[model samples]
Target: MQLTVAPIPFFWSKDTWSAFYEEIAETSVDRVVLGELVCSKRLPFFQDQIPGAIERLIAAGKDVALTSLALITLKRERKLTADLVEMGLEVEINDLSVLSYLPKGTNFSVGPLVNVYNEGTLRWLASLGATRICLPPELPLASVEILAKEAEALGVTIEVWGHGRLPLAISGRCYHARLHGRTKDNCQFACEDDPDGLDVATLDGQPFLTMNGVQTLSDSYATTVHQIDQLRAAGVTALRLSPQSQGFADLCHQYRALVEGQCSSEAVLNAITGQTPEIRFSDGFLTGDRGVAMSTPPIAART
Candidate 1:
Protein backbone atom coordinates (compact mmCIF):
# COMPACT_ATOMS: atom_id res chain seq x y z
CA MET A 1 0.00 0.00 0.00
CA GLN A 2 1.13 3.57 -0.64
CA LEU A 3 1.76 6.07 2.17
CA THR A 4 0.67 9.73 1.96
CA VAL A 5 1.70 12.63 4.19
CA ALA A 6 -1.26 14.88 4.96
CA PRO A 7 -0.93 18.65 5.28
CA ILE A 8 0.26 20.11 8.57
CA PRO A 9 -2.71 21.15 10.70
CA PHE A 10 -0.69 23.14 13.19
CA PHE A 11 0.75 26.66 12.97
CA TRP A 12 4.48 26.30 12.30
CA SER A 13 7.15 28.85 11.43
CA LYS A 14 8.35 29.03 7.83
CA ASP A 15 11.76 27.59 8.67
CA THR A 16 10.32 24.57 10.46
CA TRP A 17 7.71 24.10 7.75
CA SER A 18 10.26 24.19 4.94
CA ALA A 19 12.59 21.84 6.83
CA PHE A 20 9.77 19.34 7.37
CA TYR A 21 9.03 19.13 3.65
CA GLU A 22 12.77 18.94 2.91
CA GLU A 23 12.87 15.91 5.22
CA ILE A 24 9.68 14.49 3.66
CA ALA A 25 11.33 14.53 0.22
CA GLU A 26 13.72 11.89 1.56
CA THR A 27 11.12 9.65 3.21
CA SER A 28 9.38 6.52 1.85
CA VAL A 29 6.03 8.25 1.39
CA ASP A 30 4.59 8.19 -2.13
CA ARG A 31 2.40 11.30 -2.10
CA VAL A 32 2.05 14.46 -0.01
CA VAL A 33 -0.95 16.81 0.42
CA LEU A 34 0.68 19.97 1.70
CA GLY A 35 -0.83 23.40 2.33
CA GLU A 36 -2.77 25.21 5.03
CA LEU A 37 -5.64 22.88 6.02
CA VAL A 38 -6.79 24.28 9.34
CA CYS A 39 -6.68 28.10 9.59
CA SER A 40 -6.16 30.37 6.58
CA LYS A 41 -4.56 33.01 8.79
CA ARG A 42 -1.45 30.83 9.12
CA LEU A 43 -0.86 30.56 5.36
CA PRO A 44 0.89 33.90 4.83
CA PHE A 45 3.83 32.94 7.06
CA PHE A 46 4.89 30.00 4.84
CA GLN A 47 3.06 30.46 1.54
CA ASP A 48 6.20 31.62 -0.26
CA GLN A 49 8.00 28.34 0.47
CA ILE A 50 5.36 26.15 -1.24
CA PRO A 51 6.71 26.49 -4.76
CA GLY A 52 10.24 25.49 -3.80
CA ALA A 53 9.03 22.64 -1.66
CA ILE A 54 6.86 21.29 -4.50
CA GLU A 55 9.77 21.45 -6.90
CA ARG A 56 12.04 19.54 -4.50
CA LEU A 57 9.44 16.84 -3.76
CA ILE A 58 8.71 16.38 -7.46
CA ALA A 59 12.44 16.03 -8.14
CA ALA A 60 12.54 13.35 -5.45
CA GLY A 61 9.78 11.40 -7.29
CA LYS A 62 7.05 12.19 -4.77
CA ASP A 63 3.55 13.09 -5.96
CA VAL A 64 2.63 16.44 -4.41
CA ALA A 65 -0.81 18.06 -4.10
CA LEU A 66 -1.95 21.36 -2.64
CA THR A 67 -4.69 21.31 0.02
CA SER A 68 -7.67 23.68 0.35
CA LEU A 69 -8.55 25.21 3.67
CA ALA A 70 -10.81 22.97 5.78
CA LEU A 71 -13.16 25.87 6.45
CA ILE A 72 -13.31 28.77 3.99
CA THR A 73 -15.15 31.95 5.00
CA LEU A 74 -13.47 35.18 3.96
CA LYS A 75 -13.42 36.57 0.40
CA ARG A 76 -9.64 36.07 0.29
CA GLU A 77 -10.09 32.45 1.31
CA ARG A 78 -12.52 31.97 -1.59
CA LYS A 79 -10.01 33.54 -3.92
CA LEU A 80 -7.37 31.19 -2.57
CA THR A 81 -9.62 28.21 -3.38
CA ALA A 82 -10.15 29.50 -6.92
CA ASP A 83 -6.41 30.02 -7.38
CA LEU A 84 -5.54 26.43 -6.42
CA VAL A 85 -6.64 25.35 -9.89
CA GLU A 86 -4.19 27.79 -11.50
CA MET A 87 -1.31 25.83 -9.95
CA GLY A 88 -0.22 22.90 -12.11
CA LEU A 89 -0.31 20.33 -9.30
CA GLU A 90 -3.38 18.46 -8.16
CA VAL A 91 -5.66 20.13 -5.60
CA GLU A 92 -6.87 18.25 -2.52
CA ILE A 93 -10.30 19.61 -1.56
CA ASN A 94 -10.85 19.76 2.17
CA ASP A 95 -14.04 21.83 2.03
CA LEU A 96 -16.90 20.87 -0.29
CA SER A 97 -17.39 24.51 -1.27
CA VAL A 98 -14.07 24.32 -3.11
CA LEU A 99 -15.83 22.30 -5.78
CA SER A 100 -17.94 25.34 -6.77
CA TYR A 101 -14.71 27.16 -7.64
CA LEU A 102 -13.08 24.44 -9.73
CA PRO A 103 -13.55 24.40 -13.48
CA LYS A 104 -15.54 21.60 -15.06
CA GLY A 105 -13.64 18.30 -15.41
CA THR A 106 -10.68 19.51 -13.35
CA ASN A 107 -9.02 16.50 -11.71
CA PHE A 108 -8.67 16.83 -7.94
CA SER A 109 -8.55 14.79 -4.73
CA VAL A 110 -10.61 14.93 -1.53
CA GLY A 111 -9.15 15.33 1.95
CA PRO A 112 -10.58 13.55 5.01
CA LEU A 113 -12.17 16.75 6.29
CA VAL A 114 -14.91 16.47 3.69
CA ASN A 115 -17.84 14.28 4.74
CA VAL A 116 -17.50 11.37 2.31
CA TYR A 117 -19.24 8.86 4.57
CA ASN A 118 -21.30 6.91 2.03
CA GLU A 119 -21.00 5.43 -1.44
CA GLY A 120 -23.34 8.00 -2.99
CA THR A 121 -21.11 10.83 -1.74
CA LEU A 122 -18.10 8.91 -3.00
CA ARG A 123 -19.68 8.41 -6.44
CA TRP A 124 -20.81 12.03 -6.63
CA LEU A 125 -17.30 13.27 -5.89
CA ALA A 126 -15.81 10.85 -8.42
CA SER A 127 -18.17 12.14 -11.04
CA LEU A 128 -16.96 15.65 -10.25
CA GLY A 129 -13.33 14.60 -11.00
CA ALA A 130 -12.09 13.39 -7.65
CA THR A 131 -9.47 10.80 -8.50
CA ARG A 132 -8.65 9.89 -4.91
CA ILE A 133 -10.19 10.36 -1.45
CA CYS A 134 -8.86 10.03 2.07
CA LEU A 135 -11.76 8.75 4.15
CA PRO A 136 -12.59 10.52 7.39
CA PRO A 137 -10.73 9.17 10.45
CA GLU A 138 -13.96 8.51 12.37
CA LEU A 139 -15.21 5.92 9.86
CA PRO A 140 -15.32 2.30 10.96
CA LEU A 141 -13.55 -0.40 8.94
CA ALA A 142 -16.85 -1.84 7.76
CA SER A 143 -17.80 1.49 6.19
CA VAL A 144 -14.28 1.77 4.81
CA GLU A 145 -14.52 -1.63 3.15
CA ILE A 146 -17.83 -0.77 1.51
CA LEU A 147 -16.55 2.56 0.26
CA ALA A 148 -13.23 1.09 -0.93
CA LYS A 149 -15.13 -1.49 -2.96
CA GLU A 150 -17.22 1.24 -4.57
CA ALA A 151 -14.17 3.44 -5.10
CA GLU A 152 -12.44 0.63 -6.95
CA ALA A 153 -15.40 0.36 -9.30
CA LEU A 154 -15.45 4.14 -9.80
CA GLY A 155 -11.69 4.16 -10.55
CA VAL A 156 -10.92 6.32 -7.51
CA THR A 157 -8.08 5.60 -5.11
CA ILE A 158 -9.15 5.20 -1.48
CA GLU A 159 -6.95 6.28 1.40
CA VAL A 160 -7.44 5.73 5.11
CA TRP A 161 -6.17 7.90 7.94
CA GLY A 162 -3.29 5.73 9.14
CA HIS A 163 -1.73 7.96 11.74
CA GLY A 164 -1.77 11.21 13.77
CA ARG A 165 -4.24 12.91 16.09
CA LEU A 166 -7.86 12.64 14.89
CA PRO A 167 -9.24 16.03 13.83
CA LEU A 168 -12.54 16.09 15.70
CA ALA A 169 -14.06 19.44 14.72
CA ILE A 170 -13.50 22.98 13.48
CA SER A 171 -15.22 26.09 14.77
CA GLY A 172 -15.47 29.77 13.85
CA ARG A 173 -14.51 30.73 17.39
CA CYS A 174 -10.87 30.27 18.31
CA TYR A 175 -10.39 28.21 21.45
CA HIS A 176 -6.76 29.25 21.84
CA ALA A 177 -7.71 32.91 21.63
CA ARG A 178 -10.57 32.49 24.06
CA LEU A 179 -8.27 30.79 26.54
CA HIS A 180 -5.99 33.83 26.54
CA GLY A 181 -8.86 36.35 26.94
CA ARG A 182 -8.51 37.57 23.39
CA THR A 183 -10.81 37.57 20.38
CA LYS A 184 -10.03 35.71 17.18
CA ASP A 185 -8.76 38.78 15.31
CA ASN A 186 -6.41 40.11 18.02
CA CYS A 187 -5.11 36.79 19.38
CA GLN A 188 -1.61 37.60 18.00
CA PHE A 189 -1.03 34.11 16.61
CA ALA A 190 -1.10 32.45 20.03
CA CYS A 191 -1.51 29.03 18.46
CA GLU A 192 2.09 29.17 17.25
CA ASP A 193 3.41 28.79 20.78
CA ASP A 194 2.14 25.18 20.87
CA PRO A 195 3.31 23.76 17.57
CA ASP A 196 1.59 20.40 18.11
CA GLY A 197 -1.44 22.00 19.77
CA LEU A 198 -2.25 22.74 23.39
CA ASP A 199 -3.65 19.81 25.36
CA VAL A 200 -6.89 20.24 27.29
CA ALA A 201 -8.01 18.34 30.35
CA THR A 202 -11.32 17.39 31.91
CA LEU A 203 -12.64 18.85 35.11
CA ASP A 204 -10.78 16.14 37.01
CA GLY A 205 -7.60 16.83 34.97
CA GLN A 206 -7.97 13.78 32.71
CA PRO A 207 -6.75 14.48 29.17
CA PHE A 208 -9.63 15.36 26.85
CA LEU A 209 -8.66 17.04 23.61
CA THR A 210 -6.16 19.30 21.85
CA MET A 211 -6.79 22.88 20.77
CA ASN A 212 -5.16 24.29 17.62
CA GLY A 213 -6.59 27.66 16.72
CA VAL A 214 -10.18 26.84 15.77
CA GLN A 215 -9.62 23.12 15.27
CA THR A 216 -10.07 20.48 17.94
CA LEU A 217 -8.15 17.21 17.74
CA SER A 218 -7.89 13.98 19.69
CA ASP A 219 -5.36 13.62 22.48
CA SER A 220 -4.06 10.25 21.21
CA TYR A 221 -2.58 9.44 17.83
CA ALA A 222 -4.78 7.29 15.59
CA THR A 223 -2.54 4.51 14.26
CA THR A 224 -3.12 1.78 11.68
CA VAL A 225 -0.16 -0.40 12.61
CA HIS A 226 -2.48 -3.36 13.16
CA GLN A 227 -4.83 -2.66 10.24
CA ILE A 228 -2.37 -2.66 7.36
CA ASP A 229 -3.25 -6.18 6.25
CA GLN A 230 -6.97 -5.61 6.66
CA LEU A 231 -6.95 -2.31 4.75
CA ARG A 232 -4.93 -3.83 1.92
CA ALA A 233 -7.31 -6.77 1.82
CA ALA A 234 -10.22 -4.33 1.52
CA GLY A 235 -8.59 -2.67 -1.54
CA VAL A 236 -7.53 0.51 0.21
CA THR A 237 -4.86 2.12 -1.95
CA ALA A 238 -3.02 4.36 0.51
CA LEU A 239 -2.64 5.41 4.14
CA ARG A 240 -2.53 9.14 5.02
CA LEU A 241 -0.21 10.11 7.89
CA SER A 242 -0.60 13.56 9.43
CA PRO A 243 2.41 15.72 10.25
CA GLN A 244 3.83 15.90 13.77
CA SER A 245 6.67 18.08 15.09
CA GLN A 246 9.02 15.42 16.51
CA GLY A 247 10.63 12.35 14.98
CA PHE A 248 8.30 12.58 11.97
CA ALA A 249 10.76 11.26 9.40
CA ASP A 250 11.49 8.23 11.57
CA LEU A 251 7.75 7.73 12.00
CA CYS A 252 7.45 7.54 8.22
CA HIS A 253 10.19 4.92 8.08
CA GLN A 254 8.45 2.77 10.69
CA TYR A 255 5.12 2.97 8.85
CA ARG A 256 6.91 2.19 5.61
CA ALA A 257 8.41 -0.96 7.16
CA LEU A 258 5.02 -2.03 8.39
CA VAL A 259 3.48 -1.45 4.95
CA GLU A 260 6.22 -3.49 3.25
CA GLY A 261 5.70 -6.49 5.51
CA GLN A 262 9.26 -6.11 6.89
CA CYS A 263 7.93 -5.92 10.46
CA SER A 264 5.06 -7.24 12.56
CA SER A 265 2.31 -4.96 13.82
CA GLU A 266 3.37 -5.51 17.42
CA ALA A 267 6.96 -4.66 16.56
CA VAL A 268 5.95 -1.45 14.80
CA LEU A 269 3.67 -0.43 17.64
CA ASN A 270 6.38 -1.27 20.15
CA ALA A 271 8.92 0.84 18.28
CA ILE A 272 6.49 3.76 18.13
CA THR A 273 5.64 3.46 21.82
CA GLY A 274 9.33 3.18 22.67
CA GLN A 275 10.01 6.43 20.87
CA THR A 276 7.11 8.29 22.50
CA PRO A 277 6.01 6.24 25.45
CA GLU A 278 3.91 8.99 26.94
CA ILE A 279 1.70 9.30 23.87
CA ARG A 280 -1.18 6.86 23.56
CA PHE A 281 -2.10 5.08 20.32
CA SER A 282 -5.61 4.15 19.21
CA ASP A 283 -7.26 2.06 16.46
CA GLY A 284 -10.69 1.96 18.01
CA PHE A 285 -12.24 4.30 15.46
CA LEU A 286 -11.61 1.66 12.82
CA THR A 287 -12.30 -1.31 15.07
CA GLY A 288 -15.85 -0.31 16.05
CA ASP A 289 -14.92 0.46 19.63
CA ARG A 290 -14.52 3.68 21.57
CA GLY A 291 -12.47 6.18 19.62
CA VAL A 292 -9.81 6.32 22.33
CA ALA A 293 -9.50 2.60 23.07
CA MET A 294 -6.13 1.05 22.27
CA SER A 295 -5.92 -2.56 21.21
CA THR A 296 -3.69 -4.76 23.33
CA PRO A 297 -1.20 -7.03 21.49
CA PRO A 298 -1.69 -4.52 18.60
CA ILE A 299 -3.27 -7.15 16.35
CA ALA A 300 -6.19 -8.16 18.52
CA ALA A 301 -8.66 -5.97 16.60
CA ARG A 302 -7.85 -7.35 13.17
CA THR A 303 -11.14 -9.23 13.02
Candidate 2:
Protein backbone atom coordinates (compact mmCIF):
# COMPACT_ATOMS: atom_id res chain seq x y z
CA MET A 1 0.00 0.00 0.00
CA GLN A 2 1.17 3.54 -0.81
CA LEU A 3 1.83 5.81 2.18
CA THR A 4 0.23 9.31 2.18
CA VAL A 5 1.24 11.94 4.73
CA ALA A 6 -1.79 13.93 5.78
CA PRO A 7 -1.54 17.66 6.61
CA ILE A 8 -0.46 18.74 10.07
CA PRO A 9 -3.57 19.11 12.29
CA PHE A 10 -2.04 21.25 15.00
CA PHE A 11 -0.81 24.83 14.80
CA TRP A 12 2.95 25.15 14.29
CA SER A 13 5.18 28.15 13.65
CA LYS A 14 5.77 29.03 9.99
CA ASP A 15 9.39 27.91 10.02
CA THR A 16 8.53 24.66 11.77
CA TRP A 17 5.80 23.95 9.22
CA SER A 18 8.17 24.70 6.34
CA ALA A 19 10.89 22.49 7.87
CA PHE A 20 8.44 19.60 8.32
CA TYR A 21 7.43 19.66 4.66
CA GLU A 22 11.07 19.95 3.60
CA GLU A 23 11.83 16.80 5.57
CA ILE A 24 8.76 15.10 4.12
CA ALA A 25 9.78 15.90 0.54
CA GLU A 26 12.76 13.59 1.02
CA THR A 27 10.82 10.75 2.66
CA SER A 28 9.76 7.53 0.89
CA VAL A 29 6.09 8.50 1.05
CA ASP A 30 4.24 8.47 -2.27
CA ARG A 31 1.85 11.36 -1.68
CA VAL A 32 1.50 14.43 0.49
CA VAL A 33 -1.70 16.32 1.41
CA LEU A 34 -0.88 19.96 2.24
CA GLY A 35 -2.79 23.06 3.34
CA GLU A 36 -4.87 23.77 6.43
CA LEU A 37 -7.72 21.41 7.29
CA VAL A 38 -8.74 22.67 10.69
CA CYS A 39 -9.20 26.35 11.61
CA SER A 40 -9.12 28.72 8.63
CA LYS A 41 -7.50 31.45 10.70
CA ARG A 42 -4.36 29.35 10.96
CA LEU A 43 -4.06 29.19 7.18
CA PRO A 44 -2.70 32.71 6.76
CA PHE A 45 0.17 31.97 9.13
CA PHE A 46 1.80 29.55 6.74
CA GLN A 47 0.01 30.49 3.54
CA ASP A 48 3.13 31.74 1.77
CA GLN A 49 4.99 28.51 2.54
CA ILE A 50 2.46 26.21 0.80
CA PRO A 51 3.39 27.03 -2.80
CA GLY A 52 7.09 26.46 -2.11
CA ALA A 53 6.40 23.24 -0.24
CA ILE A 54 4.18 21.94 -3.02
CA GLU A 55 6.82 22.82 -5.57
CA ARG A 56 9.53 21.05 -3.57
CA LEU A 57 7.38 17.96 -3.08
CA ILE A 58 6.48 17.80 -6.77
CA ALA A 59 10.12 18.29 -7.71
CA ALA A 60 10.95 15.31 -5.50
CA GLY A 61 8.47 13.14 -7.50
CA LYS A 62 5.75 13.04 -4.83
CA ASP A 63 2.11 13.60 -5.73
CA VAL A 64 0.75 16.56 -3.78
CA ALA A 65 -2.81 17.71 -3.04
CA LEU A 66 -4.24 20.72 -1.22
CA THR A 67 -6.76 20.12 1.57
CA SER A 68 -9.89 22.22 2.18
CA LEU A 69 -10.97 23.31 5.61
CA ALA A 70 -12.77 20.69 7.69
CA LEU A 71 -15.49 23.16 8.60
CA ILE A 72 -16.05 26.21 6.38
CA THR A 73 -18.63 28.62 7.84
CA LEU A 74 -17.56 32.08 6.82
CA LYS A 75 -17.71 34.21 3.67
CA ARG A 76 -13.92 34.52 3.56
CA GLU A 77 -13.59 30.75 3.83
CA ARG A 78 -15.95 30.26 0.90
CA LYS A 79 -13.84 32.60 -1.21
CA LEU A 80 -10.72 30.72 -0.15
CA THR A 81 -12.22 27.43 -1.37
CA ALA A 82 -12.96 29.00 -4.72
CA ASP A 83 -9.36 30.16 -5.01
CA LEU A 84 -7.95 26.67 -4.31
CA VAL A 85 -8.93 25.43 -7.77
CA GLU A 86 -6.64 27.98 -9.40
CA MET A 87 -3.55 26.51 -7.71
CA GLY A 88 -3.28 23.77 -10.36
CA LEU A 89 -3.07 20.93 -7.82
CA GLU A 90 -5.56 18.23 -6.88
CA VAL A 91 -7.80 19.33 -4.00
CA GLU A 92 -8.76 17.04 -1.13
CA ILE A 93 -12.21 18.04 0.05
CA ASN A 94 -12.61 17.80 3.81
CA ASP A 95 -15.79 19.90 3.68
CA LEU A 96 -18.76 19.55 1.34
CA SER A 97 -18.95 23.30 0.86
CA VAL A 98 -15.97 23.02 -1.47
CA LEU A 99 -18.02 20.96 -3.92
CA SER A 100 -20.09 24.01 -4.74
CA TYR A 101 -16.95 25.91 -5.79
CA LEU A 102 -15.11 23.23 -7.73
CA PRO A 103 -15.29 23.68 -11.50
CA LYS A 104 -17.41 21.09 -13.28
CA GLY A 105 -15.48 18.03 -14.54
CA THR A 106 -12.66 18.77 -12.11
CA ASN A 107 -11.67 15.54 -10.42
CA PHE A 108 -10.97 15.92 -6.70
CA SER A 109 -10.20 13.77 -3.68
CA VAL A 110 -12.24 13.30 -0.51
CA GLY A 111 -10.75 13.44 2.98
CA PRO A 112 -11.69 11.20 5.93
CA LEU A 113 -13.81 13.85 7.64
CA VAL A 114 -16.43 13.72 4.90
CA ASN A 115 -19.31 11.38 5.84
CA VAL A 116 -19.19 8.78 3.05
CA TYR A 117 -20.82 5.76 4.77
CA ASN A 118 -22.91 3.97 2.14
CA GLU A 119 -22.80 2.76 -1.45
CA GLY A 120 -25.19 5.41 -2.68
CA THR A 121 -23.09 8.28 -1.38
CA LEU A 122 -19.94 6.65 -2.67
CA ARG A 123 -21.36 6.22 -6.15
CA TRP A 124 -22.72 9.74 -6.15
CA LEU A 125 -19.28 11.18 -5.36
CA ALA A 126 -17.63 8.97 -7.95
CA SER A 127 -20.04 10.35 -10.53
CA LEU A 128 -19.17 13.85 -9.36
CA GLY A 129 -15.50 13.35 -10.32
CA ALA A 130 -14.11 12.05 -7.05
CA THR A 131 -10.92 10.28 -8.16
CA ARG A 132 -9.90 9.03 -4.71
CA ILE A 133 -11.44 8.77 -1.26
CA CYS A 134 -9.93 8.34 2.21
CA LEU A 135 -12.68 6.57 4.12
CA PRO A 136 -13.52 7.91 7.57
CA PRO A 137 -11.47 6.25 10.34
CA GLU A 138 -14.58 5.16 12.20
CA LEU A 139 -15.68 2.74 9.46
CA PRO A 140 -15.42 -1.00 10.21
CA LEU A 141 -13.64 -3.58 8.08
CA ALA A 142 -16.83 -4.88 6.47
CA SER A 143 -17.76 -1.38 5.33
CA VAL A 144 -14.24 -0.72 4.10
CA GLU A 145 -14.24 -3.95 2.11
CA ILE A 146 -17.60 -3.15 0.54
CA LEU A 147 -16.57 0.40 -0.32
CA ALA A 148 -13.25 -0.74 -1.71
CA LYS A 149 -14.99 -3.14 -4.09
CA GLU A 150 -17.55 -0.55 -5.12
CA ALA A 151 -14.80 2.04 -5.58
CA GLU A 152 -12.89 -0.35 -7.81
CA ALA A 153 -15.93 -0.86 -10.01
CA LEU A 154 -16.38 2.90 -10.25
CA GLY A 155 -12.74 3.52 -11.24
CA VAL A 156 -11.97 5.31 -7.98
CA THR A 157 -9.05 4.61 -5.68
CA ILE A 158 -9.85 3.91 -2.03
CA GLU A 159 -7.65 4.93 0.92
CA VAL A 160 -7.95 4.47 4.68
CA TRP A 161 -6.77 6.20 7.87
CA GLY A 162 -3.89 3.81 8.48
CA HIS A 163 -2.16 5.66 11.31
CA GLY A 164 -2.30 8.55 13.82
CA ARG A 165 -5.01 9.60 16.26
CA LEU A 166 -8.56 9.22 14.94
CA PRO A 167 -10.09 12.62 14.20
CA LEU A 168 -13.51 12.20 15.78
CA ALA A 169 -15.19 15.58 15.33
CA ILE A 170 -14.80 19.27 14.40
CA SER A 171 -16.51 22.13 16.17
CA GLY A 172 -17.07 25.86 15.65
CA ARG A 173 -15.62 26.47 19.09
CA CYS A 174 -11.90 26.09 19.69
CA TYR A 175 -11.23 23.88 22.71
CA HIS A 176 -7.70 25.21 22.90
CA ALA A 177 -8.99 28.71 23.42
CA ARG A 178 -11.54 27.49 25.93
CA LEU A 179 -8.84 25.74 27.92
CA HIS A 180 -7.14 29.14 28.26
CA GLY A 181 -10.32 30.83 29.47
CA ARG A 182 -10.97 32.75 26.28
CA THR A 183 -13.51 32.79 23.48
CA LYS A 184 -12.73 31.54 20.00
CA ASP A 185 -12.64 35.06 18.49
CA ASN A 186 -10.46 36.89 20.99
CA CYS A 187 -8.13 34.18 22.22
CA GLN A 188 -4.49 33.95 21.21
CA PHE A 189 -3.41 30.74 19.49
CA ALA A 190 -3.26 28.23 22.33
CA CYS A 191 -2.76 25.12 20.16
CA GLU A 192 0.94 25.94 19.64
CA ASP A 193 1.57 24.74 23.19
CA ASP A 194 0.96 21.11 22.15
CA PRO A 195 2.27 20.24 18.71
CA ASP A 196 0.43 16.90 18.67
CA GLY A 197 -2.57 17.93 20.76
CA LEU A 198 -3.54 18.51 24.38
CA ASP A 199 -4.73 15.31 26.02
CA VAL A 200 -8.22 15.38 27.51
CA ALA A 201 -8.78 12.69 30.09
CA THR A 202 -12.12 11.52 31.36
CA LEU A 203 -13.49 12.25 34.82
CA ASP A 204 -11.75 9.16 36.20
CA GLY A 205 -8.46 10.38 34.64
CA GLN A 206 -8.55 7.96 31.73
CA PRO A 207 -7.23 9.48 28.53
CA PHE A 208 -10.26 9.65 26.25
CA LEU A 209 -9.72 12.40 23.68
CA THR A 210 -7.38 15.15 22.46
CA MET A 211 -8.30 18.76 21.79
CA ASN A 212 -6.57 20.45 18.86
CA GLY A 213 -8.20 23.76 18.13
CA VAL A 214 -11.60 22.89 16.68
CA GLN A 215 -10.73 19.24 16.04
CA THR A 216 -11.35 16.40 18.51
CA LEU A 217 -9.20 13.29 18.16
CA SER A 218 -8.88 9.96 19.97
CA ASP A 219 -6.42 9.80 22.83
CA SER A 220 -5.06 6.55 21.39
CA TYR A 221 -3.21 6.49 18.11
CA ALA A 222 -5.08 4.50 15.41
CA THR A 223 -2.73 2.03 13.74
CA THR A 224 -3.25 -0.59 10.99
CA VAL A 225 0.00 -2.61 10.99
CA HIS A 226 -1.87 -5.81 11.94
CA GLN A 227 -4.56 -5.17 9.31
CA ILE A 228 -2.23 -4.54 6.37
CA ASP A 229 -3.10 -7.89 4.83
CA GLN A 230 -6.81 -7.34 5.34
CA LEU A 231 -6.60 -3.86 3.79
CA ARG A 232 -4.64 -5.17 0.81
CA ALA A 233 -7.24 -7.91 0.38
CA ALA A 234 -9.96 -5.26 0.46
CA GLY A 235 -8.22 -3.45 -2.45
CA VAL A 236 -7.09 -0.44 -0.44
CA THR A 237 -4.57 1.50 -2.51
CA ALA A 238 -3.16 3.94 0.04
CA LEU A 239 -2.65 4.42 3.78
CA ARG A 240 -2.98 7.94 5.27
CA LEU A 241 -0.56 8.67 8.15
CA SER A 242 -1.18 11.85 10.13
CA PRO A 243 1.87 13.87 11.22
CA GLN A 244 3.06 13.87 14.83
CA SER A 245 5.77 15.84 16.66
CA GLN A 246 8.46 13.13 16.92
CA GLY A 247 9.78 10.21 14.93
CA PHE A 248 7.27 10.77 12.08
CA ALA A 249 9.66 9.90 9.25
CA ASP A 250 10.67 6.74 11.11
CA LEU A 251 6.99 5.93 11.53
CA CYS A 252 6.66 6.18 7.76
CA HIS A 253 9.60 3.80 7.31
CA GLN A 254 8.09 1.34 9.80
CA TYR A 255 4.75 1.25 7.99
CA ARG A 256 6.55 0.87 4.66
CA ALA A 257 8.49 -2.08 6.10
CA LEU A 258 5.29 -3.72 7.30
CA VAL A 259 3.65 -3.20 3.90
CA GLU A 260 6.63 -4.76 2.14
CA GLY A 261 6.68 -7.79 4.53
CA GLN A 262 10.12 -6.83 5.77
CA CYS A 263 8.98 -6.82 9.42
CA SER A 264 6.20 -8.05 11.68
CA SER A 265 3.45 -5.89 13.15
CA GLU A 266 4.67 -6.87 16.61
CA ALA A 267 8.11 -5.57 15.74
CA VAL A 268 6.64 -2.29 14.51
CA LEU A 269 4.58 -1.83 17.67
CA ASN A 270 7.67 -2.53 19.74
CA ALA A 271 9.63 0.05 17.73
CA ILE A 272 6.86 2.63 18.15
CA THR A 273 6.71 1.88 21.89
CA GLY A 274 10.32 2.95 22.17
CA GLN A 275 9.53 6.34 20.63
CA THR A 276 6.17 6.93 22.31
CA PRO A 277 5.82 4.85 25.42
CA GLU A 278 2.93 6.92 26.81
CA ILE A 279 0.85 6.50 23.65
CA ARG A 280 -2.10 4.09 23.65
CA PHE A 281 -2.55 2.34 20.30
CA SER A 282 -5.88 1.23 18.80
CA ASP A 283 -7.11 -0.63 15.68
CA GLY A 284 -10.62 -1.25 16.96
CA PHE A 285 -12.37 0.66 14.18
CA LEU A 286 -11.20 -2.06 11.80
CA THR A 287 -12.23 -5.07 13.99
CA GLY A 288 -13.54 -4.24 17.43
CA ASP A 289 -16.59 -2.90 19.32
CA ARG A 290 -15.58 0.78 19.14
CA GLY A 291 -12.96 3.05 17.63
CA VAL A 292 -11.06 3.08 20.93
CA ALA A 293 -10.57 -0.71 21.24
CA MET A 294 -7.14 -2.02 20.20
CA SER A 295 -8.19 -5.44 18.77
CA THR A 296 -5.32 -7.02 16.87
CA PRO A 297 -5.12 -9.97 19.24
CA PRO A 298 -1.65 -11.23 18.39
CA ILE A 299 -0.14 -7.75 18.44
CA ALA A 300 -1.94 -6.93 21.69
CA ALA A 301 -0.54 -10.11 23.25
CA ARG A 302 2.93 -9.23 22.01
CA THR A 303 2.65 -5.78 23.53
Using lDDT as the measure, the top candidate is: 2
- Please give, for residues 156-272, the per-residue lDDT of candidate 2 as tens digits: 999999999899999999999999998988768888889999999989999999999999999999999888888999999999999998888889889989898888898888888
Model 1's C-alpha root-mean-square deviation from the true structure amounts to 1.8
Question: Which regions in candidate 2 have their CA more than 4 angstroms from the true location?
Answer: 297-303
Q: Rate the local accuracy (lDDT) of all candidates.
A: 0.91, 0.92
Residue pairs in steric clash, candidate 2? none
Please provide, for model 1 over 1-303, each residue's C-alpha lDDT reduced to its tens digit, 9 standing for 90 to 100: 999999999999999999999999999899999999998889999999999999999999999999999999999899988888788789999999999988899999999999999999999999999999999998999999999999999999999999999999999999999999999988899899998899998999988799999999998999988778789999998999999888889899999998887877777777877777777788899994789987664445333
